[model samples]
Target: MTSYLIKSILCSGILIVVYHLFLEREKMLWFNRFYLLSALVFSLVVPLISFEIKPENVLKPVITAVPQIMEEMQKTGVINSMIATAESNSPPDTMQLLLFVFDGICLLLLIRFLVNVSSVLRLKSRCRNVKIASAKLILVPENIVTYTFLNNIFIPEKTFENAQVRDEILAHELAHARQMHSLDVIFIELIHVFLWVNPFLFWYKKAIRLNHEFLADEAVLKEYTNVKSYQLLLLDTVLQGRQMALTSSFNYSITKKRLAMMTKIKNLNRQYIKQGAIAVLAFVLTLTFSEKIYAQIEFKSKEVAATFPEISIVRFEAVADKPAKKPDQKGKSGPGISKAEIDEFYKTIERNTTYVKNKKGRTDPMVRMEPKMEDRMYELFSQMDTDQLQMAADSGIMVFQMPIPVKKAPTPEMFENWKKPEIFGIWINEKHVPNSELNKYKYSDIAEYSLSKLYGGALKGRIYKYQLDILTNEEFDRTYDRRANDRVIITRVGWVGENRPKSFAGRRI
Candidate 1:
């Protein structure tokens, strides 16, 4: 983007100087004082309409800036709703979206080959060549060197025959090229083309032009043995200056002040660094006013946490139901949970219900820092699977540790209890499967292997087994463990149900 700014500024000077050289002065009597206006119009109307603009190319930071704006918007409204804004194009409205599109299109036009080619065509004819000049080429006009990019050189029939005059002329153009007045002219033209809206840009162009002439004049005096010789040559060129359609000349009559600057003896380096610094500073300041885009997303996840720099919770929603109840119809032996057991469940629930509700109604403290991220986390958890919600809700989490099934002569009671549905999912970790030869234990092993690792308890032999003696249906008094007098506290609950393990005659570890 900075590069484009520099490039455009450079081209502006070239175009302006070229136009002044080629076009004749306007004769509109009423607009006599509007010579500057005419020049301005030429700079504005000519290239702008002469070329074309399209969104397909050109430098567009505005498009890039959109995403950044969106990100900022989201951050600002974390706990609330998105704040919407808009823009339009009519009447030169700047914030309008369409105008932004126009801005982007304009910025992008610099890249087109057609525009550069057009610029080249406008200044088609080369200025006179110089054998004595040390530069690639020179365009010293017969009039005061106009610094304007156009035809400053007034070519007449007998111009080159005067040896002393020609040498002085060579001295002057060499001054222009050495000091790079031509390049400076191009730079000003570019600034005018793109930044024509800026009034200060016009002043800057003039200042830079004046400086160029100053530098060139100094060079001419250094090259000539006597300052008088150069001054006489400049005078001769200025008097007989015949205008050309498209060249910068030695003595452009309009820029007489610039020639006078060249004639003066001056110290160049005393302020060179200071002036260069000012130009650089101005160039840098322009960057603060730029256009580019970026976006933001709030994501919350324990799994996703490892990958991201900031783990923002986007949405969280909790499912409102419990896991499907112990499947019915299967011949299952459920522990006859008594009134004592139900009371214990309520006690567990009461222990952890201390929740803080914020203005946005988030239930977790981790979410409050970034409202949007928290809201997202809340939404996700609120809508989670029933099994997860039930697990979160349940205080008495059961941890099952399945034991290896050692094959022994199968007892009638063991076989009978193993075939029940109440004990479906239960297992130890994968490593407990034992040798492959124990494959027979894979079938019907749930009750035999599963035991409460949290509280020494087990379910086997068609009954809910614990350390307490198993009683018949009549003897079972209702309680959490079916022991009316004693209650066991349940902590973490998990069922590592491995269907792959052999179920035949299994036992708890």
Candidate 2:
């Protein structure tokens, strides 16, 4: 919603600047009126339109690698201890509070609009009517400026005595009545009730009112013979102009512009050139506004791949073993299993297992496990390395793969103690869950998990912390089939970090 408001405001501002630059001084009164109205409608609608450019299927290979590793981890029981935790800093009720404030402001403006319309109706009812040519002349008791609302031309009761001034006022107001300029004023007032926050709308209203005056002035000059006398009559009535939004007054604020427009020569030959330029400008503005609309949509595949950079797995290392305690002379037991027993168990597993070596001579443990014997394989490994296994349980170590060498590594001090992983939160479909509810599900139920940073107003400078996104099997299979090279992106989370398969930047995940 906020993004849409911003886009609307920006689009309105650009259109208004274009009007002031090219169309303001042109004698095309109807063109200017339509242009300003079109701008208003465009501002309200353009933000809702969305356009997207589909990227080519060039990234399929890079994205398949992460899912393969995830599959291997599930089979090997590596992700059994995975845990996640996240902290929300934004107040839960802030969005509601903002909406309430906005609605209240709009309500007040709506009431003001109603009041202005009612006041005009009240004035019309109280005035005395007298017919003059094709217009209904309304003689008011108060000393107010002459103006037109609908077919009624209002004038001060005293103006009836001065025939010349009365005729001039009547002619000017008759032009307003004939042109139906009051409809434009009423339309803009209604628009103001809702979009009062946009200052460009206010400028647009002013431009509209000014163009109405130009149209009326042109109409009055075509009928009235004495030009100099009419000019003097305008100067005389300037001070008596009333500040009313609902009515088109004879003497509007822009008296100087009116006088200049009257004498300005019409250039009919240049009309086509100016019209062509306006058409070109409109096309350019449409493209500009369309770009803003398209910016709001999330990209499908290529964008996801760009977010998760390729991270090479180096090797796996067993955490350092603790020293074993000796038995007491009294034949009492010590705190832990003896070192000789642990060594013997480790030797038995090593003799039975086979490890595959890659081109870099790094060993992959998953390659040795048989398909149906996973449970028995896990039982053998668990019994052989009970101490390290217990440490993995308490520390929440999912898979302990070393990361490829990079420019910067976590400080050695970060690894001095067996640092337990800090569970932040679980994310499914980009929504955070503050508890371990996901642990009830089997690893096969989950397709894959991506480590990325969560972003929001609440999470502002804490972008380095990792968010674990768990994808359901269905979502994973569909994405993998449609765009296998595309990464499974968790919306509202930023790109994955450079350091992979380790504590995020030395801080526990």
Candidate 3:
């Protein structure tokens, strides 16, 4: 999920960079319009496409080695995976809380979108409709600028009184209605509702809005030959209007680009050159963001088999690989684990502790297994010959881990000590701050924390013995600010093999 978001953002960024560098300056308004919409839609789509390459094409040097010792450990029963332990209570999952926050914000934006649409609908139903020359104008009571929504051109009662400006404004808005620019606004707004955090969407919106103004200006100039008068009128117009996300406003502060594009001469050669460059960029981005899969290949060498038989077995097994599921936390009952038996085993070890001299030259308790445990251990190894036993001893003692019930994830309540006044210095997300900084956050916002004793450190001329560090859930942090990080990170990580889920967003996009 993280990878998909990153790839989509990166692809959008690359396309945006090319547009700004090569296409924006050229006199190719039509091509620019097509490219802007196509690039945005392509950015959203290219990350979901992938190409598979057969393993025969992949280099063998870097991919041949496989870890086979893990398989041996599994066969020897040394990797006990079924050990069960008692379950304990835990804090609220931060990820779930972040998800809830995201959905809540999306709902609010959706409602706001609907409200804007309804307000337009209400105006369409109640306002006086006056048809002038080929345009439908909705005369509203408010002192706002002329704007277009769907098929209706909304005109302010104050702005409509002027005879000369009215014709020009209506002509501009008619172009918008004819070109269906409102649909573009609606589509981008819907995207903004969900992916508002994506900075590229904001850029895309600006580009889309600016392009609409250019198109409208081109249409108005075709009818009215006075480009200077139109530019002056645009400059003279005030930017006081009710900003609607779904409507294209006539008084947008994009007069400079609109005026420049009106006088600029169209060069066919330059347009073709820019289009070819954009095509190359699109192709490069497709390959860069795409997921590449390779077919399974088994390399067998007689020399490698004579040197390491285990690695050869692993290579063969790699030809038919499947996804490995993570071990379940709430394990079922299995061998070598029972509450009563574990308690008895610990009691035996405690009884057999003996005093011995340590490296510090002080006598400390050394724990040893009781004779009964020693007899059981010997019985397990009785079948091995002397050579096998010597080899085992040379490999050193192996400790088999048993699952113990404990709190693994940090809880918000655990930071209560640091929250107390003047008790410990607080640091949230690696920034030093006062203890009061924690007041705004809840348990579900924190991902993890650490406490450490400060030996001889003073902060703000006050001596502190301990300090607390906190790392909040990133999803929670991102909700507060959408433009926090401007840098885009592109990664080539993806899932492979037949076990990959069939109903994933990346696969469907």
Ranking by lDDT: 3, 2, 1
How many clashing residue pairs are found in candidate 3? 0
Candidate 2 lDDT tens digits, 1-509: 56667778888988888888877887888888888888888887877654443322111121222443433443454433332122244354896898888889899988988888788778878878888777787877777877788888877777765553556567778888887878877777777777777788888877888888888887878888677887898887778446566788755468888888788786877867877876777677566665321111133321222212333431221111111121111221234444564444333333433343333334322112222233333333334344444433332221111122112211232111112223233555445443355545555565555433223321232222333455666665556543432222211111222332223223333
The C-alpha TM-scores of every prediction are 0.32, 0.54, 0.54
- Once fitted onto the true fold, the runs of candidate 2 whose alpha carbons sit more than 4 angstroms away are 55-92, 131-135, 161-165, 291-509
Q: Model 3 over residues 1-509: C-alpha lDDT tens digits?
A: 45677888889888888888777867777778888888778977887786654532222221122223223433554222211110112233765787789889889989999999999989888988888655578888786677889888888765676653556767888999889888888888888788666788888888888888888888999999898888887877647657666888755467677778888998898788778877887888888887653322232221011111223222221111221222121221223334454344334433544444333343333334533463443333333444433322332211111112111234433444346534456667656666788888776666544443323212222334344555577733453242122111111111233332222222121
Candidate number with the higher lDDT (2 or 3): 3
Best by lDDT: 3
For candidate 3, the per-residue lDDT at 36 reads: 82
Candidate 1: worst-modelled 10 consecutive residues by lDDT: 57-66
lDDT of 1 by residue, 290-407 (tens): 2111111111221011111122333211111111122112222233344454343333323422333333333321111233332333333334344433433342222111112222
lDDT of 3: 0.57
TM for candidate 1 is 0.32
- Candidate 3 is scored at a TM of 0.54
